[model samples]
Target chain A: MTSKALENGRRSKRHIFHKAKVNRSHAGNAVVFTCILILGAFMALPFVYALGSAFKPLNELFLYPPRLLPQNPTLDNFIGLWTLMKSSWVPMSRYIFNTLLITAAGSAGQIILASMCAFPLAKHPFPGNKFIFRVIFLSLMFHASATAIPTYIIMAKLHMLDTYWALILPACASSFGLYLMKQFIEQINNAVLEAAEIDGANIWQTYIRIVMPMVKPAWLTLMVFSVQSLWNIGSSTYIYSEELKTFSYAVSQVVAGGVARTGTGMAISVIMMVVPITVYLITQSSVMQTMASSGVKE
Target chain B: MNTNIKLHSLQKRRLRDGITGFLFTLPFVVGFILFIFSPVVMYLAMSFSKLSLNDAGAMVFENVKWDNYINVLFEQPDFLKRLASSLGDFALRCPAILFFSLFIAIILNQRFHGRALVRAVFFLPVLVYSGAALMFSNDALSNDYFKLLSSDSDETVNLAQYVISVLGGTEDSPILDIVSTLMDKIYDITCSSGVQILIYLAGLQSISPQLYEASSVEGCTGWESFWKITLPMISPMILVNAVYTVIDVLGNPTNTIINTLYSLAMDSGNYGLSAAMGLIYFLIIFIILGAVFFVINRFVFYEENI
Candidate 1:
């Protein structure tokens, strides 16, 4: 009877501790809630600022005190862009077409080529495998900015400077995508691949069927990254023809067109930003997975 | 003799796998060499040579030893100063980026109302901060923003100055100077922290709840549990985020070296000096990465229990 009483007394003490913990957490929750609310507002401010400026008329854009919201909203900026394009040497639709084609081709090419390289590098124990991967990691350390002049020189020699291949091909050679894909592929169980091999599936069959399907999340993550980057490529120093220029390049030109083009510039930015934001909204969870697995663990 | 026969078959299988690997990596390797590696080697060679256009407008290079490197180091007015300023900004920004992202990630990890919407809002920067959109916004909006702030007679600008002064400072005051710098850079800081927050959130979620529960059972408070459990477990991610932040911060559009190099090569027609500047800047980056990799490798914790 005494032992049972002691157990009851301990249970009551634990319950009291739980009550204190819950009270403290309620206070902690308030503090956390305020911090997140302020931060979320700060984070959302730029999008709001951009959106507001996009809808503003030219006069409102220069208003004193610089209102975050437009005093007078209008679609004239977008209409102006369309009209401006109508007067230009190259048709606006062509610029749009060029951009869409390049983004689609570059991203799709990068994903496929990176995956192909990543699969074998991740799964196979072959001669020079470690050495090849090390070279890639080392290349990541070297900044590509400094190489622009020589790259231009080499492109001139190859006679590929003005071609669409100049833009697409160099981008496809990126090691970042390959690195990300390789990391994801390494996490796949070897037994799964072994089972396919035992069933008489060749290496190609295993990669296309088993590996590709298993790493779908990584595929989407890479897709988000590639599409976003390809969309942002502004001016290529190599591509001089107006017809061959990207939509982003055109948008930058519109921005540089002076004070009259201010509203148009804002509209173009909003249009450019909205697509990637939409994609991220859909694939947020998977992108987090990609980033988590990105770290090189010991 | 039997063991030798077994080893022979194993060797054959290894050679088969090796060929398969080579074939798979062939496309990327070829592209890498043609596009990435060749330019890098050409840049190195061009740095030591005088490059000029011929009568036919074709390029010709004549070897010119250490002249380019010496000129960049001693003669150029803007090269080293720009590099130092960029490095200083990098130092100031890295800690703030790490601290806020960690703080935001922890809060986001908590069960809160409309968490998904909040996450989408925060992640907006990662989407918008690249390409033409970012350039446009940075150029167009910042022009308007600066105009608003600098108009001395305006009420909002006046009120802002009043409040800033109340927080305490004249033009040369250090406390107010840091505050103003932070205020100016607030947008950039928020934008860059988005991906870092997501990475930290993933790290936070990967921590098993049972550990938290056990710590609570042992009478640890929330703050105490965070220090003892959350910090140690996510130490690896801290290293990753630090490296990622370093790359991203240095890779912004207005990077001084890139701007200076472009002007030197194209406008001023000084190819060799530009190439030399590029090589020195690259070496600085290499040294920085090596140091970070060494320091972080010592601290990053791996989960052994799994």
Candidate 2:
């Protein structure tokens, strides 16, 4: 037993030594860093260009060799966009409010419902568990457009045609969120859950307390995806009311206003992108923290 | 008598567990039936029928049997051709996107200075490539700029061609064709991979540090640990990402099949033909997903329940 203990100590020391060597490898680190930097810049180019173009004056927008950075930056585009929005039939703030309402409700509902559904499917053995999962998986294979008309008809029948529920309800039912949450939940060790059960915590309580907190990163990632898609929802066939249109729909209108509104269009793009990017930034730190502690030990 | 009583309670507990499980999944089951399954069934029916509006403007379905399918499959000049090419593109790009995103995810998961900023930059594509920003970037002025940029790269293309010839490969060789196609599509691959990278990063982080520690204690190298431990641990995510990539690529707005279907439905007002085409597209997607899921599922290593 003393010899076994000694061997274990030596092994751990060697492990620590190896880890230090890996971390202190400067040449490999430099190569990885440089590659990431170059790729990051390449990926960020279009967004940076868009930002610059939003600030460019009219003539600068039309420059033949389009400048990556606007030579003469101005706020004219933003001001123009404001004026254009002010002249619209529906108020700009209404569009923003509509988008916020839809995105918030849709994402929250999806995360909650998907997680609630995913827990049982992931952990519990029921009569139709596998069948339900298979169905959900199959649903994710097709594009949403294939179901658009029939969904519209269903919405009409339910008398939900013009309201925000038209958008929120369908998003709440999205198969992708359930699938993602299920996968993440499956990574959790069953022992943690069994311990909870032995403590007399019921299924629902355990799910709320144990499963939900454990899979925080999954739901957060789902939020990013849900918000991104819901925020970008443009004119829908089911919603014909001008008051019910989305901010993206309004932005598309400004974009459609022809060549003269190019500056304002770019400005609107910046505005539209800011919300989702901000959402990602705020949640990213939490996502990383949760993921760090998410590992299950045998 | 005591054992019989214990068995009765055991059966009751199982019954409770089953009911509770069913109740938990109730919301999704209801939502799926109402929203997804019903619509899919309706679309299938529409695919096999002639959809026309009545005087009251309600849709009328006249049974057309196989006509719509026949028209889409054999008669439409560009439909089959576009489908074939799009499938080919999907075959090439799905694996590329998966590999590239995994590579980027591994890099991002490493501890480094300015990691958060680099991550934010990497996720920029998910923001800018969707909605209004995409439309803005595809505007005429930007298109002109891109055209000019390509023209300016003529010298670089010539140099590449000369190098290829020197390497004993013709410009139009199949290998060169694939390489050039991939080269041209690098921006697209990068743009479409943001969410994928996020998924992978999450997957990477969920892998227990204990496994790595144990492997290191066994004198395993970093490379070996990656293949043996990390790969198996992340295989489930690989399945998820693979399915997502396939669907995303096929359903992309710019895909030829999608564009053709859109035009057939909206521009030409041929709903029946469009529905038929959509069903066919969905079948292809289902087949591809099934193949991917089957192959990846076999390799996916789920930790056994304790």
Candidate 3:
């Protein structure tokens, strides 16, 4: 028993020495980890504070050294939020439906449209193919702000202002989605296409059948990117129609005017902001994992 | 005769493929011309014309001169000051955002507990706060409202007066004063490019673990291995983030040029100056981005090189 105890003591000493050596070697990484955590908390302050304030007693909100966490919290803010700008501000349900419709439609349209655009760029060898791809690439980096005025004017001319078509038609041919799809398709093996050809499949058959299966990861990535535009405030802000308001527009409206009441305003914004993201988290949990993983190339 | 037949078949195949490609890109081409190309040309034309609300509140287009541009650029005080302030804000915010985000990306790439959850939280702000969350939170955090509570006077509650108590610290305060100066840059970084850190982290992980193993076998420590191994591997992603951040901020509607455009269309009826400002904004971004691409191409080491 005494011999065993001594042996255990020696083993533990060696383990401690090894761990200390490892920690000393990676002291820099630990420092970096701490900095990252702090910055993350700093960046997350508004959201965390919103979450905290959303649940806090209205009387406690203005307390200095603001409570990072709520004390004696309730859902009264949410109760108040649901009824905000109650008159003539479009029903909350309508706003949510509008947003959902736009997000679903826009994402579906982009995937289909971008895939069609990507097919030739990825597989077909045509003259000026490189030039066409370059044009798409250049436009992919173009910000909405740069050409928003033009887009607005065009939408007006089409009599699409304040209508569903305003959101749908202008953004259908997304250069970002096309460029991303082409990049994804290029990673698929030529062997897959060759196999499909051997099986007497046409070009479309190969693309839809063999090639697309390999690019499931790409599809999820595009879905996430499309949601950004679909839910974006910038485009909605410029599109300029009250009846055509999206989820983002609704959220902005809750805060924009006569919202001098801070906690309730924050509560409304948080719900509007979180509703879609929460839905995404639940439905696309697996896709989120794949999305992050695909961000890296092997 | 056999050579002629084969050449004819080849020509026909090329023609078929071209037609297919054109059909695929037809929507983008049509959308681009109708929405992007033609509208830009029209706006430039509109700037030279007289566009205003009539007594009946209908928009009337009358051909005017270069007066609009001259008035906004040379004569307007709010326009110039807002432009200068926005330029200052952009210059101040962009670098701090780039460094802090890339730095966090490196930290996240390390093997750690709760790494995925950490990434999700970091990315959450970017996805949500860029919209309504900011405007609402801005009201709460905007001003000093604490003073209003202590005073029992029957006046209206000055909410900003209450909140300003937290941030009313002097320029001489030790820790928080530094935070104050850096806070705007940090908030912008958090709001705009927090998701980018996740992208950069993925780029870092895609780096082969073998590189570190090989470096260590040759007696390289973590720091030296980083300089030799990490930066080169993630350079392409760095370019992606830089261009995205720059273009995103430059095109923000709250920006002076965009606000000017909105006001001109809605309030002022000075279409010509708005067009010039919009074009000038686009030109500046284009030139800066071109310069970035040139430098990045020269310095960045690609995996293909490896």
Query: Chain A TM-score for each candidate, in the given order?
Result: 0.83, 0.91, 0.77
Ranking by lDDT: 2, 1, 3
Fnat of candidates, each listed: 0.45, 0.57, 0.28
Tens digit per residue, CA lDDT, model 1, A9-76: 98888789778988998998898888777767756665676788878887787664456678788998
Best by DockQ: 2
- How far does residue A203 in candidate 3 sit from its true spot (Å)? 4.7
> Per-residue lDDT of A178-276 in model 2, one digit per residue for the tens?
988999888888888988888988899999988888778678889999999999998889789999999888888788777788788778777888888
lDDT of each: 0.73, 0.81, 0.62
Q: Which stretches of candidate 1 lie over 4 Å from their true place?
A: A1-26, A119-123, A183-219, A285-298, B1-12, B109-111, B132-179, B198-240, B301-306
Candidate 3 positional error at B239, Å: 2.7
Question: What docking grade applies to model 1?
Answer: acceptable
Winner by TM-score between candidate 2 and candidate 1 = 2
* lDDT score at residue A21, model 2, on the 0-100 scale: 69
Give every collision pair in model 2.
none
Give the distance in Å from residue B32's predicted Cα in candidate 3 to where it truly belongs.
2.9
Best by TM-score: 2
**Residue A217 in candidate 3 has what lDDT?**
44
For model 2, the local distance difference test gives 0.81
